[model samples]
Target: MMLENKVVAITGAGRGVGREIALLCARHGASVVVNDPGVGGGGEGGDAGPAQQTVDDIITAGGKALANLASVADPVGAQSIVEDAVQHFGRIDAVVNNAGILRDAIWHKLSLEDWRAVIDVHLNGAFNVSKAATPYFREQNSGSFVHFTSTSGLIGNIGQANYSAAKLGIVGLSQSIALDMARAGVRSNCIAPFAWSRMTASIPAETPEQQARVERLKTMSADKIAPLAVYLASDASQGVTNQIFGVRKNEIVLFDKPRPVRSMTKTTGWTPEAIADELIPAFRPSFARADEVSADVFPYDPI
Candidate 1:
């Protein structure tokens, strides 16, 4: 019972990674608040069925759960989720900001509506949920936050400019939250999980070769990622804040925080010409090659 008696609220718990996290948390003895607006995969339309179904499943497995239908992007709605947890379960020990939607388009072809939609759901949604829940965590003097990020943001992707921006924002946001709450015993960490969730399933793979690749990728199940989220939510990973972790099939990756790979300082301000001559050549060897992406880093399944 790693999370015994703990109350945890997970957004987007209706399906995919969020669904798995809720189930795993409950199996580990946590009372879960499954929050899902039941929106369509693109964040349109809604239903209560998904959240309710998850709750029913959890209870049937001998666990406590509450169904909450609140869009984490709405401040008042997000606040209601925190309040719902406190009122129903007595206290909330963890908040997992797993709510998200996908609106993928190439940078040149991306629309403003699509951009805002993704940002609001992923970035603002996380902020709203975390902001509403932070005061309680501060007062309780203990809590954990697990924010969902993606390798698309960590590295780069062909399309998904909005998603990449929003996910990277989560990384920075988690770091700041971790530092700000360290003295209060609140830990925040980000995870870039490579699993076959609804988001990945949406990718069009029409060619036979692409279809076969997608089939092999089915091995990377959402359930495989739940254990990491469970550990991060439990006391086992205490004092491990502000770190970014990646889970890909049987492999786990620890990404290095941004640091200068090579540095050259000019004590006196350098002219543009001097910079072109010195800086360009000095850093050329260390420069990242063009078009490196997440898939390239871990293309094959783990041995």
Candidate 2:
């Protein structure tokens, strides 16, 4: 009963990882708010069935739950999700910014429309919900935020320029929220999860490598990510914030934040030519492999 008497609002809870987290949170005694517009993988069209189904299941299991068919991409709709939590449950304890869509295209061929679409849903959507929930959290002097990031941004991926940028931006957002809201007893953290969800199913499998990677991903289920997410939302994880974690099947990993790896300085700062001659060679060995993708970094089978 880690979350007994608490209320948790989860975006994208209609299906996949988000759904699992919502169910688990409810089972652990939290009154759950399952929010999802039921949009497609690329953020088109919508249905209310998904969110309602999640709530139905929770209630059948003897748990408290509510459904919200609001698009996280809209600020007003996002605000409604939080408001619904407070209006119904009387208080809100956690917000999980898990709503997202994928619009994959190579950097050059990626259209402005596609770029903005991805950012609006992933980056701006997270902000909208978090911003709306902030005042409530601040006033209550307690709250938790669990944001969904991805390996495509943390490591690398092909034909996902917009997605990568949005996911990485979420990391920065999580860090800032954690720092700025600490005095309010609020915690924020990110999870870069690997699972065979609708998002992964949409990845292009044109290449042999991609097909292989997709096959590998099929072994990991969305439920494997629920435990960590529930823990983050609960009081048990009181001191854990401003961190990044990865969950792949049976494995859980703590990721290091960006930090200076190597440094070089000249007593008198030199010209570009000097930098080329001195800096390039000194940093050559430490340079990250430009060609490495998520699969390349995690070549081993999911365990």
Candidate 3:
């Protein structure tokens, strides 16, 4: 019962990794707030069924939980979610920003609507919830935040520019929060989970072979991602902030902090023409090819 007597509010807990995280946190003796507007993978349409069902399951298992039907992108809705946790459970010790939506489109074909929709749900949504909980964390002198990043963003993916941008932005936001809240005993970290969820189910299989890969990946359930999330939400991960961790089945990967790999200098300065001629040639060998995608990098069996 690492999280005994603690309350953790999880966004998008209606399904996917968020749902698993909520269930695990409850099992670990934490009061849970399952907040999800119950939107589809594309962020279209909403239902209350998923959130309520998760809450019901937790209660049936002899755990404390409440259902919150709120869009994480809505500042007021986000604030009320945190308030509800406090009023019902007395205090919130952790916040899991797992709410998100997908709007996949290649850069040229990506519409303004698609870009805004993803950013609103992912980046801005993280802001809304974290901002709402900041004062509470500070007042209580402690808290934890586990924000979701993605390999799509960490590496690169074709047709997911919007998603990649938002996911990477969450990492930047988490790191800044870790720096700000360190002295208050509050910590923030990011998780780049590689789990099979509805989103993966949505991937179009153009051929039988492609379809088989997706089917095999189905075995890598969202449950695998929950353990690291719960650990980060508990006192066990205290001071383990500002780091990015990955969960792909049983494999746990720690990404190095972004650092400069190469530098070019001139006693004076180099002109754009000079950089193009000199720097480009000097660094081109180290630059990752634009065609490389997530699958090429993480070829391990998802199962």
Report the poorest 10 consecutive residues by lDDT, candidate 2. Answer: 294-303
Provide the lDDT at 95 for model 3: 96
lDDT of 1 by residue, 151-189 (tens): 889998778999999999999999999999999999999
Write one digit per residue (lDDT tens) for candidate 2, span 1-303.
Answer: 899999999999999999999999999999999999999999999999999999999999999999999988899999999999999999999999999999898889999999999999999999999999999999999999999999889987889999999999999999999999999999999999999999999988889988998998899999999999999999999999999999999999899998998999899988999889999899999999989888877899966
- Give all candidate RMSDs, comma-separated: 1.5, 0.9, 1.5
- For model 3 the local lDDT of residue 187 reads 95
| RMSD versus native structure for model 1 | 1.5
- On the 0 to 100 scale, the lDDT of residue 243 in model 2 is 98
Off by over 4 Å in 3: 207-213
Candidate 1 Cα misplacement greater than 4 A, ranges? 206-213
lDDT of each: 0.91, 0.94, 0.91
Estimate TM-scores for all models. 0.96, 0.98, 0.96
Error at 163, model 2, angstroms: 0.7
Error of 2 at 53 (Å): 0.5
Model 2 lDDT, residue 132, Cα: 94
Off by over 4 Å in 2: none
C-alpha positional error of residue 65 in candidate 2 after TM-score superposition, expressed in Å: 1.0
Ranking by TM-score: 2, 1, 3
